[model samples]
Target: MDLLDFARGPAINVAMAVLVFGVLWRLFALLFLGKPVDRTIPRLGTPGPFWAGLREIGRRMLPHPTFATAERFAFFNGWVFHVGLAIVVFGFRPHILFIKNLTGLSWPALPSGVIYAVGAITALSLIAALVKRITSPVQRFISTFDDYFTWVVTIAPVLTGLAAVGHVGARYETLLAIHILSIAVLLIWLPFGKLFHAFLVFLSRGQTGAFLARRGV
Candidate 1:
């Protein structure tokens, strides 16, 4: 098959398989790590672990005041791109159709104009995120190769999706194929990279919350 055919067909299928299995593997491994029994009875009036964990999930969405000043930029920037990405991914007509085809699920799409605008904003936010990461002395000092690589993988689909829509640098067919390929690459890399935090962050935050609540912290 041609590049476009290969990208849309086998490559995407394989990537999806990897994403599903990789995520399941990680989750199961974490589960099998075995929760430690807390001998300390929860302080009187404290919520149970499940409730405390749920509460913590919401609490950790915002920065603690002590670190808010330092974290505010990243937090806001992350929200902008994250929201924009979600809109573009779930609100675009073509993407909705793809979802329907894959899982027999579909939703109404936003206008093409809205999708385009949101996609552009998402790409710009991603660029700002990269700039922030590289320019911040503390963050840059602590950053590893994984940080930058994951960033690239995360942003590739966004950039390519915009490019495909705008028909930038290539014919529409070619641009579309490249966009699909970028998405495939993202799916393949996600579970193996820092992006896996997308799944783990809530779990970790919840566990911490439960632990602290049990101790009456």
Candidate 2:
């Protein structure tokens, strides 16, 4: 039996359902339960404090012109890793096909080689980031259990994908099974962990924008 075939059937469906629900639940909770803004930070150029925070977030998201410095390299690598992982996870042909079949919506599919390359790059970048966290005193000081757990959870899918591709330590079916299982675990853990911040970030940014608008600084 094909491992990929197994993942395509009930197991994949269940995992996908859980992932969708978990993400939604966390988002809903954050939307309703998160505290209101206490104070606004002043914007550098904008008239209000809220605009400044929004601008800071935008700056953080953009790529610097050069990666000559360590900070610039880290920022670029971090963003590249996130974008690459998103493309591979959501834009791959099989994933798109599955979504089309399940939800009656279709998206453009990325090429197979590109999907694999993006996954590989994301895996490498995650590893580098984890290493930095472990070796750098500043990062280590700021790191918490959730931070390390998030790294492991985030990296597991990429590593498992590589293993499944390489047919590591077992039959392709077995490796694929492990890969699917890891994804299922990630889905369940996401809502309860720092990974939820993936969605929370946007909400936080919007809140910052709103606060700035109210202040009219």
How do the residues 6-90 of candidate 2 rate in per-residue lDDT, one tens digit apiece?
Answer: 7657666786788789888767776678676567554444545455566646854765556447577578788888898889889
Off by over 4 Å in 1: none
lDDT tens digits, residues 74-169, model 1?
Answer: 999999998998899899999999889999998888999999999889889999999998999988999999999888987888888888888899
- CA lDDT scores, all candidates in order: 0.90, 0.77
Error of 2 at 109 (Å): 2.1
Q: List the lowest-lDDT window of 10 residues for candidate 1.
A: 33-42
Backbone clash total, candidate 1:
0
lDDT score for residue 197 of model 1: 86
Cα lDDT for residue 16, model 1? 98
In candidate 1 the C-alpha lDDT for residue 78 amounts to 91
Which pairs clash inside model 1?
Answer: none
User: How far off is residue 70 in model 1, in Å?
Assistant: 2.2
